[model samples]
Target: MRRLFRLLTIYAVFARYRLDELLPDHAASGIVKFFIRLHPAAWTASTQVHPWGRLRLALEQLGPVFIKFGQLLSTRHDLLPEEAIGDLANLQDNVPPFGEQAAFDIIEAELKGTTEALFGHLERTPLASASVAQVHAGSLKDGREIVVKVIRPGIETLVQRDLALLLTGARWLQKIVPETKRFHPVQVVTDYRHILLGELDLGQEAANGAQFRRNFADSPVLYVPEVHWNLSTNKVLTMERVYGVPVSDTQSMLAAGVSLEHLSELGVEIFFTQVFRDNFFHADMHPGNVMVSLKDPQNPQYLSLDCAIVGSLSKQERFLLARQLMALLDKDYEQIAILMVEAGWVPQSTRIHEFQNALRTVLEPVLERPLNEIEFGPILIRLFQTARRFEMQALPQFMLLEKTLIHVEGLGRQLYPELDIWEIGRPLLEQWLRDQIGPGAIMQTIKRNGPALIEQIPHIPKLAWDALQEMRKLSENQQKLLQQVEQGHLKQLRRDRIITLLGLIGLGAGLSWGFNPHWSLSWSEIPLGAWVISALGASLILTRLRSNPDD
Candidate 1:
């Protein structure tokens, strides 16, 4: 009942935001019309008017979950309407801290020691705080500086409960509402749960940081702080302290002697290198999380922090993304559209001609401009909007990729206003394309799999026997579920059967009265007929509601 109440509260809030107005227009009118008739209110047109502001406001009202969702959604530049994407991007992670003492208590308890023992000194003041966690500064025993990160207390329970509630609601929508199948609400929730789960583990983040550090150890372009593994826990993270001018502070960067144009071009090269060469890029390198190293001003290096979120593309996804980017650089719109469906990024049923036409309409206007002026932002939004028409399910990983890319692009332009991203992106992507589609790739794949394939050949018989056993078990489980559902149906039918029979009898009597109305038509016919009709309608609706969809 509490869960149900919570759900209704969510709906009530959504109603106020005018999200309900976004529901498809007059869809399934006959039976659906009566069901939704109680709620005559419509989705707000305000979402379109100053969409960005409206989006931020809606996310605020929805709380942390929505803020996080907005953050993720902002990354899918290729999958959202321009206004919607812009609005989501504008959402600030700014939120009030819980309390200084609450943070200290968590840190001390997590380390299982006093502040003095863990560090020479610890600062109570937080450098930054967000909806999920807070960060503080401290000095180690040897006077080496570090930062202490502590998860807000009681956060896990609240997050878990909210996630559970979300899952339950998603399941209900998928099962009870046939119309939602296309939208795949349950799958969306599943992806959401996995993302939340990833965010919950600071250990994973610490490892991500360490891996990033390892990958860039020999590079001069970037520096990642080492993870103090001993000091780090699942809820608490300790790492080497880093300092530099914030990436967003352009004036400071310029004053520090960094050549803006060179710095920006370098940033572009670093982004491509990370995605293609390293295959591991910091997916959350927002301006807030990045800084510019001022030691070598003219040849600047990027100071990166906050490795809590990272993204990696599958070999196939990376290849397709590379191919699509290359195609855009080559002015091959049809190739880009073809890769969309070929990569399973869009539904196969989408017509190539229609998809290509839609993309061309979006891209041509932008492409007519010089490469130096073209921004990836508008291009990404158009791509997503067009793909969505073809029923693409935006992957969570893709969102992170786009977010990082946007951050890189914005940072680059600030350093060098005239930098042509296409010039930087094209050659790198083309080389990657050659590497991926080359004969060497085929030989490598075969060589890597050859040994495994040979070993598996010897176990084929045993593997087949094991598979048969699993199939038998699965078949039995299905039978048992079927039986259980049948019993439940029988129980329900027993209860409704009496009501249905009484309803029929009442209906017959009402019909008889109407016929006898030939002798004397009276007001009794109206009441009798109404009751009979109500009862029959109620029975039918209940039966439809009660029956299991699978059954």
Candidate 2:
């Protein structure tokens, strides 16, 4: 019943926005059109809001999840209409805060103390509020400025409720619309479920921030705020407050003497570095989660926030992805197809030539376009679509990385429209690839794992003995299974011989009756049973022979 209410609410929002116009006239049935026409909001929608603008407004009104969905769609500038993407880009996450008292109560509960007891100063008002958490300014007893992030009260229940609705809708679409299978709506929702749930755990976010800080320690490109572990819990997180110009405020950055051209290049460099060099990245890098430091105006630095949804790829994936990108740079569609099959992204049975041609058809046009006119986000999306034809399963991490890259590249292009991402990123990726196969990387890997390797050396003999025992046990099990199979085959052969003998007897009796009609077993007296037995035996022998054609 609650789900029904939510569904109706969603429909009402759509009707209110007159979003049906976004769909084609042939998309809906006459009954749905009639009902839509009868709806009051359909006619009464505010005139000020344009047809495309209503999409963003309706999502905003629906709730945070919907707003975030719009934000995600906003990244796909190539796939979606420019006007729609423009409207969605304006979907701010300035959700109303839960009361100060609720925020304080959550902090107290998580920290096992009152807010006054825990901090020298705790603000009653929140500094900023978002979909999942709210931030409050405070000072520690040691005079350190910090911000307290508290998870919204009962957000888990809301997330679960909405996720159920989303999954239901996805399943409904898949059932009603067969073409939707290519989109993998259910898997997308499941990936989203992990991300949303992960955000609810403030401790994980704190850890991610700490790791990011460590990764960029003594570096000049990016800065991650220090996480105050003593004051943090799964529900409450405390970190050093950072102040800087938001990355989106281009005017402020420019006025502050920050080089937009260099800044744009740095954004691409940072993304590739995080993906290939560090192997860990802040996945949700919308402008809201990033800031620019004016202190280094000549060489500006990025301040990252909201590290809850970080992403990483396996060692092999990192290598393959880099190689694939390099292949794209070289316009080697054959290599791309081969790498895809080797990586198990596509079926091993996929025709290499056909796959290469399909990719070439999709990618050649974009590649032929001018460098500055190209968009990487939409190209990757189109590649995924093309891969769907060969039954390639989409990787969740790859998709996240794509979205983050899109955010970074899109923002970079916005900051400097002439930002050539391919031009900037190609050299960095090549350097990283060289590093991977270099001696320095091998030595570094050994040094990093030295302690663990030494510890395992002591157990080598025992480990080897145990492995041998396990293999012996597996061999015994296999031998027993083979014996059982052989016994069954022997039993079948014996039955076949019996059937053949019975068939010969029946055939001989039938022949005698046919040749000597006056005999006791006369042709007229011979029952249907004799003929059936003869046919059954002959069929068994023929089937057995066919099964073993070599015989």
Please report the candidate that would top lDDT against the real structure: 2
* Candidate 2 TM-score, true structure as reference: 0.78
lDDT digits (tens) for residues 393-501 of candidate 1 = 7677776777778788888887777878878878888888787779987898899999999989989999999999999999999999999999998887776666556
The candidate scoring highest on TM-score is 2
Summarize candidate 2's per-residue lDDT along 198-241 as a digit string, tens digits.
88899899999999999999889898899999999999999998
Error of 2 at 282 (Å): 1.2
Error of 2 at 487 (Å): 11
Provide the RMSD of all predictions against the true structure, rounded to 1 decimal.
15.4, 5.3
TM-score, one value per model? 0.74, 0.78
For each candidate, the alpha-carbon lDDT, in order, equals 0.77, 0.84
lDDT of 1 at 131: 73
lDDT of 1: 0.77
User: How much is 460 displaced in model 1, in angstroms?
Assistant: 16
Q: Candidate 2 clashing pairs?
A: none
The local lDDT score (0 to 100) that residue 20 gets in candidate 1 is 42
Counted clashes in each candidate structure: 6, 0
